[model samples]
Target: MYRSEFYVFDQDKPVPVIIRNYTQDDFDELIQIQSECFPPPFSSELWWNKEQLSNHVMRFPEGAICIEVDGILAGSLTGLCVDFDPNHMEHTWEEITDHGYIKNHNPSGDTLYIVDISVRPRFRKFGLGKLIMQAMYHVVIQKKLVRLLGGGRMPGYHKVADTLTPQQYLNKVIKGDLKDPVITFLLRCGRVQIGIVENYLEDEESCNYAALMEWKNPFNRT
Candidate 1:
């Protein structure tokens, strides 16, 4: 178990937060959290099912982590090891994450590819998502992986889709002229934008585009 303490904005004091590997018992809660995180436009059909969650913990327990505040399951971050080629990083979420089943997990892979990360809406003020991401970074270091990579959603894009192209919007976000809920948060967590990935997922807000981001393992000797 990976443990830490954090201060919740509305709480009186710091709460005990624990990051632990995904287990069979967390299936229902995990699905519930997914539903709350990605409601209507995000596609309920894409939510975590028994099969995918089972494969995640079974195939790579270390790559799947959940965070609890006090005692409530507040969020989760899931990933899979992959032999990623930085030069060819144009795959869709389904292709890279094996449709969230992680059936393509490579034990000897150089990168830890993040599939999903979400924090409960009520707990979003506590910086839990960043903490969960830090847990993934620890996993990357433990496994001696080269980096952590993921296709991040641009939920703030569609609001300006009529006025800005995806790339243009991304540029503004990077330059701090604009802030995207997902991309801005990821950027603050030490990830850098690689490029804009088209058709990365089916989210109307993003116009079906994703921001490819990566956090290099500075300590990696390879």
Candidate 2:
């Protein structure tokens, strides 16, 4: 039921943009977007299925949201609540997200854990991803969560893995010497690099590694 509308420019033309909670009706477009965003070696089988998407909207409606640009499904962000401990942050994506089913979503948990965020290639230039993330930040505040956290893919790591360690690569990215597609995007969204997690995902580019990042909610009194 959460909805927000605005306009973005497309070559001097004002295009409509909408950010809202997901519903069963958006399943088809959501799946299509997943396929387009994570194609081929990214593993088609890992793409969001109807059942998992169903669990998302049903279990945590506010955390499962999508964005539309000029009426086209342009992006989405899905998350869940968890009782996070900064001292014990090691966990794989499958373990954290319940293999994308999110059956372990804890409504009383203090942290908003992002499961995934995808933006269509054509819509990336419009900063749609950031807007989607902003919506999730709103959700964290509305739900009174302490922070937002996620494991970011280092898709650009493979090209330099032979010469750099994962931590070294991440350090360089933080120091502005390197730019990773996912990590850099998250950095721009006000997320801080927490650490590197090995065996976090099945991505070849990242050598099965993921960069942990988080954004603390300033308004949370707890």
Candidate 3:
């Protein structure tokens, strides 16, 4: 259980938040938060089952982290190490996260596959997402991993799903011609859209397609 304290602005006033590793005790809270943060189809069917949940802590103990602000379980993130050639493969969340058990996770792998992150609804506007992302970066450097990769639900897509292709919409958002709360924020955090992943997730807002992204570690530069 790694622990640290940081602050993020809440309505322009800084509020203190805690960052640390996930614990079995927090599992129920995680499940509750997932239900609140995501919809039924995805949240219910796709969450880590009992065995997978246990394996998360046992396998990649160092990478699963949680966020707390004033003793509230405000957010959390869990990752797994994956060995893959960036040039030749693309994987769905299940394939890379190893169906949540992370059964194939290689502790010495080159990439950190971020499988899940959830922020409580009330805490969403306080910049917690970026804070958690920085924590993930810290994990990459701490583990000496090469880079991080994942797919994110494009919340902005539902508004334009009928009018534009996923790629076109993402390009516009990337170019600043369009604004996407989720995708835009990640872009600011130094991740870029690698491509569109079909059936990447079952979220309603993104229409089941996620924006594939990657962030290289600054520490990896040599």
TM-score of each: 0.94, 0.96, 0.89
Root-mean-square deviation of every model:
1.6, 1.2, 2.2
Error of 1 at 86 (Å): 1.5
Comparing 2 with 3 on lDDT, the higher-scoring candidate is: 2
Superposed on all Cα atoms, model 3 deviates from the true structure by an RMSD in Å of 2.2
Q: Give the alpha carbon lDDT tens digit for every residue of 103-217 in model 3.
A: 8889778999888888988888877877888888888887788888888778889899999999999999999999987889889878987778887766678898888788988
Instruction: Return the top candidate by lDDT.
Output: 2
Which structure among the candidates has the greatest TM-score?
2
Q: Residue 146 CA error for candidate 1 (Å)? A: 0.6
After superposition, the stretches of candidate 3 with alpha carbons farther than 4 Å from their true spots are 12-14, 39-43
Query: CA lDDT of each candidate?
Result: 0.90, 0.92, 0.82
TM-score of 1: 0.94
Q: For candidate 3, what is the lDDT? A: 0.82
Encode model 1's per-residue lDDT on 13-99: one tens digit a residue: 767777888799999999999999979766788789999999999999998899988889999999999998878878899999999
